[model samples]
Target chain A: MVKRGAASCLLALALPAGAAEFNAALMVAPEVDTPNTASPYYVGPPLVPDRASRQDLELRLREGGFNVQETLRWQTIRDRTPEQHGIANQFYYDGELGDGLGWTAGKKLMSWGVGFGFKPLDVVQRENRRLVNRPALVGAPVLAVERFTADEAWTVAWTHPGRGEGSDDFRDASLALRWYRLSAGGDDLHAVARLSHRRGLEAGVGATRVIGEEWSIYGAALYERRTRRLMNMLVGNGGTLAAADPMSEQVGGGGTKAVAGAQWTGASGWSTLAEAWYDADAYSRAQWQRLDALTASQHALAGIAPAAAIAGNVAWSSQAYLTPNLLRENLLLRLGYDDRDGFRPYAELLATPRDGGRVWTIGAAFEGNRQRLALGLRQAGGADGSAYARAPIRRAAWAEWRLALF
Target chain B: MSRRLAALALAVALPASAAENVAALLKQADAFRLPAESVRVETQVELYKNGALDKERLYTVYVKPGRRSLVLMKSPSEIGQKVLMLADQFWLLMPESQRPLRITASQKLLGEASTGDIASMTWSEDYDGVVEDEVDCPVPPPNLPEATAPPKPRRCLHLDLAQARSGVTYARIELYLEKSIKLPIKADLYVGSGKRAKEAWYVPKPIEGQQRIMAMLLLDDIQPNRRTVVHYRSIVPKAAPDEFFNPAALVRNSLSGW
Candidate 1:
């Protein structure tokens, strides 16, 4: 039914009598990995297996005062069971409503905040953890209205039936508003407020300024109230399932997240970015030590049948509670060189300062007239009780080929 | 003295006085480089490294002197990128970004060419010129299809230009202007330490419905074997809407393929 709906929307966009354009691409990627432990936790087969392929199609149309855009993707993974999925990535219609007002409605990807890697105000979409090099966010259905002048803009949006993990039903939707300003010295300032039926109120502020010819700095901070709190699940005496004990619960206490970053670009096409992220709700150093000890005990009990269930529960709890930048303090660094013609090489490092754990990714891409080829390698390193010590895959290598079609 | 001899000497002195004023020569050259009113043009640039094609890009530009100018990238990797210049300020917009980013004019755009080099052409407004010399120079012929003869040496005015603005990329430049048309023929750019950084050649091309003018520019790096050629394909004289220069329009017309 979802596929049929997407097809209908595509047809509707195509039927308009106006100038339309279409673009498409096909990509095939293959990878190999080495697990950190012999018995690794599996999450229903990896989304990207040893080999995977994807096809994407995009269409755009402009008629009168309205603009329409649509993108569709089909992906398949070559695993033991072979999995496939089709997605309507983005479809939106934007038009002016007179009186300096404009509106957009449909499914679309929206991004907020000023951080390069970690965004505190980007609440609509869940971050893709597997691929840290590129952002892969799912679009949500929304209606947005905006008004603009020379130096200021005001926007209000309503999102219904959010598609990601923590979203609830259509009845429990979200509303957001933002005010953006550009100062005389070319500085940007933004203030945003949001209300979710299930999650209470949230507010955020972001700013960006250019320090000199080669440097730019940006930061963002967000506070949320009445949010869901993640906790460790407790097992019963006989290893029986306890319905009363849940992994997460709603709490009245509020939490805050902040991120700051800077970027520098040189005259020779070399650029670097550095960012630091902080999560107030993250586990402290002592709490993380306690969790690590509990995990060790659970691993030792995996042999006993009755205790095996409880061990699985423990593993699930650890996965649920561990979030990106969960070590309270984290840093990200990215370095890249682009000749702008075809060749580009980049490297990224994500480090947990408190636990001394880090993940490094390095890649290079060469682009031709109609094709692109890329090769990448990723490695994770940490101490015994560090954040990445229990990572499923310690090292991995991958290659991808993409061909453009019009 | 004879009356005829005195008149002849006066005529010679009049021409010499006109050539001595380098400021007038610069003002004339600037008039030939920029259009009097707003104009839109399509441009293609090719960069060569070691005599081999290294990169190429296409752009659609709208220019209104003393007001604002907008350049929209149309080809290669960054398809929907744009650059807006308003007086001393510059902003950049990427396809996926929501706000325009502030940028510096000295940033490199391609081989040997800075963003300011491609965006602004009225050199007279940014530099103060001093008369250096007047000598015979070998000038390339106008960029017309029928011209095939090798360039013969002609009398040209040589002038030294000092930057008048703080954020300009080059501190000093030596320029050569053709005596007949008062058009720039060649230039040598100098950096902070007074070292020659690059050389530029202005080639004249005939506009379809306008006066003959130099419409193509070539910049060559002094150290590396690199060169960039910019060709003004077409120019249409018309004023663009005010919104076209607004940064907010970058997001509102994100899908318009501007």
Candidate 2:
């Protein structure tokens, strides 16, 4: 169906248009991955793989003179320990039809507008890169808004993932339309209202005001009634089900949760992100209580004497599971230097305290016009056993080489 | 006594005639007042590094004045594939990536003498200061006085041209005005910020219904690091619809092939 739809659209457009121009770029990347432990799947965090190897081939094309873009990625993983192989596939497509109407369907990062609800991507060497290796494909419907403004954009169709597989399978789905208008005091007001379905029924509303050229603030709130299966996926342990068994038992509760947060960014390339949310376990309504979590992140580019920068982020989350009191704390520090000659060097560190355990990671990345190299060492150990360690004491090293392709 | 009186009168009239001629030439150069309607120009640029040709550029330009100009590159597409010129703005449309970029007024060095150190250049503004006698020109040409060597192919006017009226004027220029036309054929560009460190060549073409002339080549090839050159291949004075200059026209009227 996907192939036929794309082919027919091209054929129809090619049939008798009086000489319109079209161009495209084809990018292919082959990647390798290694994971720790028996599970070949690695989502968030890094340096957990005991020994695994995976190669990925991805192709990205921007056709129709850059108005249409499509990407397809196929990856296969071979777990040395489990002696098993798994495949991860992804596809993304975004099309702009001139006057604002557009479409986006794909596996992509789900950042709810202002890097709050979900931020799975990071910028590296002036390019947006993945923070988490695992990706979810959530097909999105796009609606254009503020057509003539510089900041005009289209809101993605869905927020939460839905059920099933392929592009349409999302755990949460959302449809939103955003428009910017003038406020009473001449400030710009951007607002969005989205009907998003997570496991159950979820909806959200958000607005932002540009106080001045240097400052802008935004806030959003979400109300959700999640499905039992979705809750089970989040809280349930890894297990296999009996084949052809319809009455198989699944774990986790189903209930509603409300979330809210605000963010502020400045023109000096300084951005401070802070968000606090309370999740009300709708599945376990009998034990319903408010759980609070907050995250603070700061990023700034400095051109001072060293011509480097200092960026840090700290996050804390209250216990979400009832069986055990688990408080999550995370800290990340990044320092880097850049110059016009195309030489850039950076160091990164991440420390996370989960339950009653601690994990720390330190790494450095260097890049230049002709070469790119990265090395990192990670150690995670604690009294309750290592959160990512084989036994509570874990250490690992990794390095990579990049080849430029025409 | 009659002979002495004749000599005195001759001396007086000679300076007066020379001064008038200088004034007329200045006026002719200043005739580049209103913008042209449409112009087509072919240019050849030779890049010189330490007195040697390193690279070259050959391109054609189409200009609808106050509206837009399109540069169709003929050679070295790797250099500048296609360039679009508009009033007060110009964009370089690359064939490889095919992206349009907004450039500042300094890029005018690569186009018709619209704006530059020569923006205010005219017949009147440049030929001021001391008016010399016909003998001052190199031998054998109206503007070429007989002071320099004939073996040399070109001649120049070395004059101290400080603006007595305003501070925005250039000081001390060694000008090479074409012998036939009393206009600056080429000039040594300078500033208080820098020396007479850059050389520019002006290829001239006679414009219809206009005095003085139009620029055919505005090449700034002396500075190797800042390789800025403009070639005005053909220029025709013709009017255009004002709407053609609007941003709406940018997307409405796509590039020729596109």
Candidate 3:
């Protein structure tokens, strides 16, 4: 049903774009993963795909005040049936009421925030940064009114309209406001506020200031009234394993998220960035240790308990790895170089210091004429007992090629 | 004794008088590129390697007062990308991210063609220099990538310029302008390290009975075999709204119509 609706919407994109700008591109991406059999919670067939081949046709159109951006995709994972999907990346309209005031209505890819590794004031989009070979983003539904000036701008938006709490962050309805000011000395300042049922009141401020010609410093912090995370009921409990599912959602009181970073670039086309971020929603060291204890105890009951039940519980625990970050505190260091001739290469290291877990990745992209190619490789490991050391996916590599059709 | 006093006074006045003349000359030289304070310039850049065309890209630049410029990428591969420069501050909006990102001076130098070279057309606002010498206009070499006209003997003004403000693409430039008309002809571009980086030559054409710069040729010193030619397709007076230059406004696509 979703595919049918998306296909119908995509058909409209091909309709006469007379006097309107039109562009399309085709992309083919393939990813390979190496699963760790030594992982205590590794799940085979149903839980993971060892390899995937994906192809997409991306189209874009702009006419007057309306624009459409969408991608049609087909992918096959391992031996599974090939899946077909489509996404409306951005379908929006902009109108002016005069007097420097404007309104936007539709699905829009909008983000009012700062920071490289993480954006604290991204209340509407709430994107997870630093994913390898990620697809184009789909915008959130928004109805917004904006006021603008030469150096300042204000926006009030109702995002994910008509949806209520209990939905995911992207789908939850919320009222958010973003205020931006360009300081006299050329610094960028941002403040944001959001009122949502799920997270309650959320507010944050961010700033980016350039020092000299090569160095830039930025930081942002957010305060949330409430935060929730899904955790296993077996954690902190004496039960070795439950016949039924033990996963439950836990809500906590006030929480905070913040990030600080600096970047430096040299005239030689070499750049480096160092960033540190804290996300309270991620599991803490204590939480990971407790979960680890439970997993160990469950393995001890393998003979006593039903083999399927034990395997099921362990598999459920692996979901912990689904989150972007495994620990509360993360530090990242990256170095990149652009040859100024369309080739860029970079390598980065992410460390979860509290648990001594680390992940490293290296990537490069070369763009020529109407063609672009990118390749990347990632690995996760650190201390022997760290969460990353026990991750099911030990290594992954991906490559993608894109060509503009017109 | 009266003759000695007269000579001393002339020397003192000559330096100060020459300083003012250079400022006026620079302003006049700027006019060859900009007919008005705010205008839209359609530009196409072609990169050549060893005299062979390598790549091409198109851009539309809206130049407003107060050292602000908004450049839109009009090519197929880079469509929907924009760079907004407000004085020393800059922001980039890419279609994939859909976010207004604050970019440093070095970040603006990324890509094959620097955004600064594409958008920035006037140099009087960013430079203050002195008239150094009067010399013959340097003719293009026969081995140049573009076709050259017959050489003609013409006097030119040699001006040595230094950056008056940060964020400008080049730190210092030794420029040569047609002495009689103050039309820019050629320049030696230098980086912050005081090292020669690129050499530029300007080509002027008749526009509505007035001579205006229509193309610029760049020869890179670092990459000896590479040359870039920037062609100005059109220039029309257009006063884009001030709101369009705001950093937060970089994400808005409605400006495509403007």
Best by DockQ: 3
Give per-residue CA lDDT, model 3, range A81-163, as digits (tens): 89888878888888888857889999898776887777878888888886777888889889999999988999999998887
Cα error, residue A350 of model 3, in Å, equals: 0.3
- Model 2 in CAPRI terms: which quality? incorrect
State chain A's TM-score for model 1: 0.84
Q: Rank the candidates by TM-score, best first.
A: 3, 1, 2
Candidates in order: C-alpha RMSD to true structure: 6.3, 15.2, 3.3
Candidate 2: misplaced stretches above 4 Å? A1-49, A65-112, A116-170, A178-193, A199-331, A351-400, B1-258
TM per candidate comes to 0.81, 0.40, 0.96
lDDT of 3 by residue, B1-258 (tens): 564355345434554533346668888999999999999999999998888888899999999988999999998889989999888778899888888888888899888998988888988899977676667888886777563743678877777788999899999899988877888889999999999989988989999999999999889898888898999999999999888887777777667777
Residues B1-258 of candidate 1 have per-residue lDDT tens digits of 263355344434546743455567787787666665577767777776666777666777787766467887665343556888776566777654444665654343422235556666667666875656566754543542222323566667777788886556677888887777776777888865577767777766656554434455454455356666777676667676554565555655532443
Tens digits of per-residue lDDT, candidate 1, A1-406, equal 3575477456745664546533445556666666556323332234214445544444444343444444455555565544443455555776777645678787655555567677777665434333633422445678898887656777788876453324342234688787777788877787777788665788999888876556778888989885454655442233333334445543547888788998887656688989998876566666566555555565556666456465455456556434655567889999988764567899998888888878898999897655778889998876666756656557778777766553
Tell me which residue pairs clash in candidate 1: none
lDDT of each: 0.63, 0.34, 0.86
Clashes of each: 0, 44, 0
DockQ of each: 0.21, 0.05, 0.71
Q: What is the TM-score of chain B alone in each candidate?
A: 0.79, 0.49, 0.91
Report the C-alpha displacement of residue A227, candidate 2, in angstroms: 11
